[model samples]
Target: METVKLGIATEYIPGRVNVGLYVSDNGARLIDSGLDDEAGRKIARMLEERKIPLQRIVTTHSNADHCGGNAFLRKRTGCSVAATKLESVVIENPFLEPLVLWSAFPFGELENKFLQAKPSEVDLIIENSGIVDESGLEAVPLPGHFLDMIGVRTPDDVLFVADSVFSEELIEKYAVMFVLDVGAALETLDRLIRAEAAWFVPSHAPASENIVPLAEANRKGLLRVSEAVLESCGEPASREKILQGIAGRFSLSMSVSEYVLNSAAVGAHLSWLRKRGQVAPVVEKGVLLWRKTR
Candidate 1:
């Protein structure tokens, strides 16, 4: 991962999951760690080369990819870790992630590192939005992709928007982005549309001076998925059938892990639509089915 400077006080390492570096009086704090021990070791080497002391790690969310390196980083540097409540739980009990996804003790494949990180204790639980004085970073709530995900806004005006928006190329490649709450995701996008920052950093996407277009694209993507879910249920289909129709339309070839993640995402779309009175559920032959209601 290469570090790009946003300001004297702020820099970030760009990768599949971007990690923000913020300098404060105490020491250098990382916004998020990368995937695992290897990622943690690499980041530690980078910091050592620069002669920076690792002091704290502020995680955006509990996604394994985002916080997987926390344990190694903390072991290496004794850095304090901070995260929102729900994410904090998952961080502390990594196995809970796969449990939530599979709704039980997950199968062997579901227990992969992609779904669960090594447990890392959180030193700080961000109870409210605004400046978190410990690291001199502001916590901007950006819920949707995961439970209680937040973005970090640096003093230098660089916003680390964690998985709130994905690039157009990412959309074309993956077709469906994982989200836990489609309604909250859309609301977060709406909030981002009016936000201004010197630079906006989305974990999976490239940083940009303007994120409005990206936000709009996310809104469109969510709407498109919602519409697809609605259209796929023309005949009152079960959740599995709805998923099959959506996957077929997108021509998505998914592994078991990918299928479960996508199924959760599709379930979010259904919940959003149902909440808005755009869809309804029925019990047919003892199986739950969903149908569009205009």
Candidate 2:
């Protein structure tokens, strides 16, 4: 097994996103690229310092903060960009289109200006369980935070788990998480815990040698969110009403944008519950009411 040098980029406050560079006989294969031009420049400099030529750039997901530097690095290193097939669409587009950030939240204007899409084209698309012949690294789909998320497992026993789990600090500060599919997220975390790996490197926090504990904590947090939603409704409530109640409970205000994002997350959870026959949705007075299935 080859010993790979790992570099972490701490873009967000207090939290670091791990972007792995697997250097082997062929060249350097990057695991995940951080958001924006700055991150790309940093990675480029790291490669330059080591005199390693970047051969490929593999992203674990399409979220802005994770794969945001794809375009920049591809432009700079001329490396092919690889991502899950489902995420290729998001990366190519890179924006929450048709959803006006300004009209949606309190920091609408700020989000609108800063959260605009930084679209990039994909050079390679990998399916779930597909092998990425990145000169020396293997990338596999992990799919939890988003439908098309992936994690790269190098020969050195390191698995780059992107945004599927976070540290306690991030969990508390970013109380509200952006998830495309809650059930999938839980399942993905479970898979990560079971997968054979020496280190679980998440894109938003420090890497963990043992991810089971953190995974358990995240599962409990998710359950807490579900319970809070159920209790706030008092009765079966529409998505909007449930979100409003959740925001009130957290002392957080919901903007239109926030509501949209939150609804998508809640809807994913509801979908999962329905699948497990744990919850059922009904129409009451023309409003959709979600109730625990009996």
Candidate 3:
């Protein structure tokens, strides 16, 4: 965990998932925790060594990688946890993540910490879009990665965008980015393009003064996944068949967890295409299949 100071009041620890730290009159507040107990411990120790107070933690979403350290941090520091509505429930009940991913009670493999984090309590639920009263931090709605994912804009003019955008290398490495709403994700990119921030920090990407290029790269990646799914539907295909075609096209070999995540992502793309009248669902011989509409 390397802490890069973005401003006098803002600093972020870059990891597989970056954690944002903002110092206010009350104390220091974190944007999101890292992947596990060790990460939380390191963050706690970092603050303690610097003599910085840990007062609040605001998670961007309910993804295990983003909030996995919440329980550990909260337990050690007694800091208040805040998240938007859709995320708060799953953060408090971590099992819901794998459960929803599997569309049922998750199997043994899906129950791992990679898919489910240790549950933590939330003290405040943020408004859809505005300044969080207690922290005085602005919450920018960057939904579509998960249900109600948001980016935090510190008073110092640095924006901590969650997983709304990914680096070009990451997009190229994993062609099929995880998304719950393709349309919303694209819209969020548009929003980011218009944002005026001195520095932008994405959880999965490097922080930069200019984020438009990264946003555009991420947009292209989403289009690539959507095109792949659309091409696979040249022949009417069931949901599983479409997923299989995607894996084959990407040379992806998956465990059950990967399959579930990709399946959800593909489903979201299909939904987006359907909404735009680019695809349609057809039932033949009692089997539902998705086919290109236009």
Candidate 4:
């Protein structure tokens, strides 16, 4: 239902999941694929229609939505996939994603397409923040959304910021975005605001020439969510109770999938607060309870 932007050497495909596309005389490169095989098939068709050979896929993270098309595209066009070392681990072994969310062997509810993408091989592992490949694309470290997440800078100076910041509209719709580290995510938003770039393309947001405003909005959103967590923890509370408080605060109706993701987000906030000496957790009678300490 969305159209891929054309008439430029580098432009992002706009959809629920935006893909950064770069085409040169040599071959075409994509910043990320999309949700599943269907999305991958469409990408392959687009490149085929242009008679452009697909070269490498630079994956930003290992999230199912981000890397789901990896296997399909690689199989269809034989494109090499690149990602950070830790992300590559999950990209190749996707079960770990559901495993971490479930905190153990995941149940059937957690084993779905959104959480478990088809296994895809990662040919290149981005080791650090610099030129990722011979194509001259640079990798900028963007921690917090996922472990070892990095935004890619194309040669055209377009920054494909992967899941680091939410679009204002998305922020309004879902006030609390999923994050693995509240502290690191806030720091990343600040970094994005300060970074110099001709354009910043957030995966779920529109591309913008100036990203400071969007970055700041995301910062405030995260802060608000963190504050909500504190408000819920005036007294000792279990993780479920804390989640319930947050849901009521936001009036969110969650399915099981949303529950696990939001639960993880709550855990991240607790960890951040605990690190800052704002909250402490105690296991009393085998029931973990969190209480505000500061």
The best candidate in terms of lDDT: 3
Candidate 4 segments exceeding 4 Å error:
1-8
Over 145-258, each residue of candidate 4 has an lDDT whose tens digit, in order, gives 988899988888888998998789988877779999999998999899889987888999888889999999998999899899988889999989999988888888888888
lDDT tens digits by residue: candidate 2, 34-109 = 7677877888887787687888878777766777677888888898888887778767865543132223433444
Q: Give the residue spans of candidate 3 off by over 4 A.
A: none
TM-score of 3: 0.97
What is each predicted model's overall lDDT from 0 to 1? Answer: 0.89, 0.68, 0.91, 0.89
Model 4 — TM-score against the truth? 0.97
List the lowest-lDDT window of 10 residues for candidate 1. 127-136
TM-scores for all predictions:
0.97, 0.83, 0.97, 0.97
Q: Which window of ten consecutive residues has the lowest lDDT sum in model 4?
A: 1-10
Error of 1 at 5 (Å): 0.5
Which stretches of model 2 miss by more than 4 angstroms? 1-16, 96-116, 253-259, 283-287, 292-294
Q: Provide backbone clash counts, one per model.
A: 0, 3, 0, 0
The residue pairs found clashing in candidate 3 are none
Candidate 3 lDDT at 121 equals 97
Q: Write the per-residue lDDT of candidate 3 for residues 1-294, one digit (tens) a residue.
A: 468999989999988998999998878999999888999999999889988889989899999999999999999999889999999999999999988877999989899888899999999999758997676789989988998999999999999999999888887776788999999999999999999999999999989999999999999999999999999889899889999988888888888888899899999999999999999999999998999986
Candidate 1 residue-wise lDDT at 229: 93
Better of 1 and 2 by lDDT: 1
